[model samples]
Target: MKNTLIESFVFLFERELDKLEAEIKQYPDEASVWKLEGDIKNPGGNLCLHLCGNLQQYIGEQLGHSGYQRNRPLEFSARDVSRAQLLNEIQKTKLVVSATLRKLDDESIRQMYPEEVLGYPMTTVFFLTHLLAHLGYHLGQINYHRRLIGR
Candidate 1:
């Protein structure tokens, strides 16, 4: 059961990565940086950065001990990052997630997560599913932002 659950999460992450890559390719270079309104924050580029940072920090560093140093603020603030750069980051994230999940056994998956996330205590499996949901949420936003602003 644990192995199946982990496999499902890996699949989710991979699917979201594919969606993100498609959105990036679909949007024009200029449009990738466009925001719908001044108050409507987080362009596709920043969202992509945020997603990569979020996964790398939570799963790679905390779970897999990958020593990823997350700059949460920079994820939201960076701008005009090229599609190629974003794609590269996505690929790296994919590798990290795959390796991390592959290393987990049933016992590890059921262990308490290293830290409290979102003000809650949970098992590693629960936290991973939460992160996967978060990824999908942002991936949807990126897709919509691209379609709305893309030329």
Candidate 2:
């Protein structure tokens, strides 16, 4: 029963992640990728990269794999990524995330992490939820920025 619930949550999360990635891939790279509107907090590609980086990092470590390079510069460095490239990256990340979540049974989720990892006290579950929320918030920002800069 518990396993089913966790899997369901993970499936739903992955579904939402897929939706956001699809929306982002629709962005016109020439204009929308680097456009930081006057009021927007972050550009579209940066937000996408942030989500991508964090997802890659967390899912990789949790699955006993090496993570993406924690290079903040690369997130924003490529301002002209083609839509196909962006979507391809997103697809790769989605597979990683889905696999990680699938393996995280209730016991694994209940596992504790060293406080040093987070700079504060938090269980693995807490961190997982935090990352999900972080991704969603940034995705919203990207969507808003898209509307503002997109025609």
Maximum-TM-score candidate: 1
Off by over 4 Å in 1: 1-3, 34-38
Please report the candidate that would top lDDT against the real structure.
1
- The estimated TM-scores of all candidates read 0.91, 0.84
| Residues 18-87 of candidate 1: C-alpha lDDT, one tens digit per residue | 8887777778765455565546598888988999999999989998899999999999888777778988
What TM-score, to 2 decimals, does candidate 1 have?
Answer: 0.91
Cα-based lDDT at residue 37, candidate 2: 66
Per-residue accuracy of model 2 over 87-147 as CA lDDT, tens digit each: 7777777787877778767777777743345687777777777777788888888777887
For each candidate in the order shown, give its overall lDDT on alpha carbons.
0.83, 0.71
lDDT of 2 at 26: 68
Name the lDDT of candidate 2. Answer: 0.71
